[model samples]
Target: MNKQTRPLLTLDQLWQFSLQYYSAREIKEACLHLQNHFHGNVNLLLTLKWLDEAQLTFAPQDWSTLTHSLTHIDALLRDYRDLRRKLKAQVSDALYKETLHFELQLEKQQQTALVNCINTLELNPCETPQLVEQYCLQLGAERLARIFIQPVQAHYHTP
Candidate 1:
């Protein structure tokens, strides 16, 4: 209800930004690399990127809340992902293709839920663009290079 509790970014905008960004061939390639090799969540990486683009900031408590909200849902996604891979291995072509479509939809559902949850959290945009990268890096580790074609490069020195 309050600013602190409501989402700072619109879910639709976040989804659109992520979708557009990920559609790029190079970005997709990099994200798949991280996802397949490092078990990175492409959606989360995109979400972090979106925040950086928006020049937004989040608190540690916000990260804790996000983790709590996403943990079970993320596990479900992992289960479905494993099942889908197994199905692909065991099933015939037509069946595998059909199941693949379902799996893709399931992934979108997860992304939607993620963006919606993020929208519920209150955040503040950076007063200066130079701080944008600093804010985004707090959300996760320095794996952006693995997931982004061009890792966001906003460098600022703190005195």
Candidate 2:
């Protein structure tokens, strides 16, 4: 609804543009055009353009599919997280002699699970701009930062 929340591109569209145009320049230009119209600022014109020309573009039909796909993915991720937490809660979960190795294995499992979750959402053309806009609204900038940063802080001590 708002200018800042527009979905300029979809995942599949991005891929197609990349394949057909051989670069994302045109898409980037479109984003910059939108930006100029909305904010009248040229500072982030290029970056906005690149984001606009990403490897995928969203579509109307893709919204339901994306919702379904993301729902399933979220469920699986939640289940995996619960399972890991339960495992950790078990006093006898790890072999006493293999504590070091077990910790390593758990860390690797968490990392692998996270990567898998991200990979599951790989950009596709079917994504709809409306869906992206909706997601952005739902998450907001600060929450988005937490979504990415919380995991890293919990596992990697990233500041």
Candidate achieving the largest TM-score: 1
Estimate, for each residue in 29-98, the C-alpha lDDT of model 1 and write its tens digit: 7677666766767777677677766767677577666556567667877787788787776889999888
**How accurate locally, in lDDT, is each candidate?**
0.64, 0.36
Cα-based RMSD of candidate 1: 6.8
lDDT of 2 by residue, 1-159 (tens): 355653443444333433333223543353344333442112122212223334344344543443443343344444544555556656474543355455434434333333233333434553222332333334343322222222112322225
Q: Give the candidate number with the greatest lDDT.
A: 1
Q: Give the Å shift of residue 19 in candidate 2.
A: 23
Can you give the TM-score per candidate against the true fold?
0.70, 0.30
| Clash count of each predicted structure | 1, 19
lDDT (C-alpha) at residue 124 in model 2: 54
Worst 10 residues of 1 by lDDT: 149-158
> What value of lDDT does candidate 2 attain over all alpha carbons?
0.36
For residue 104, what is the lDDT in candidate 2?
Answer: 35
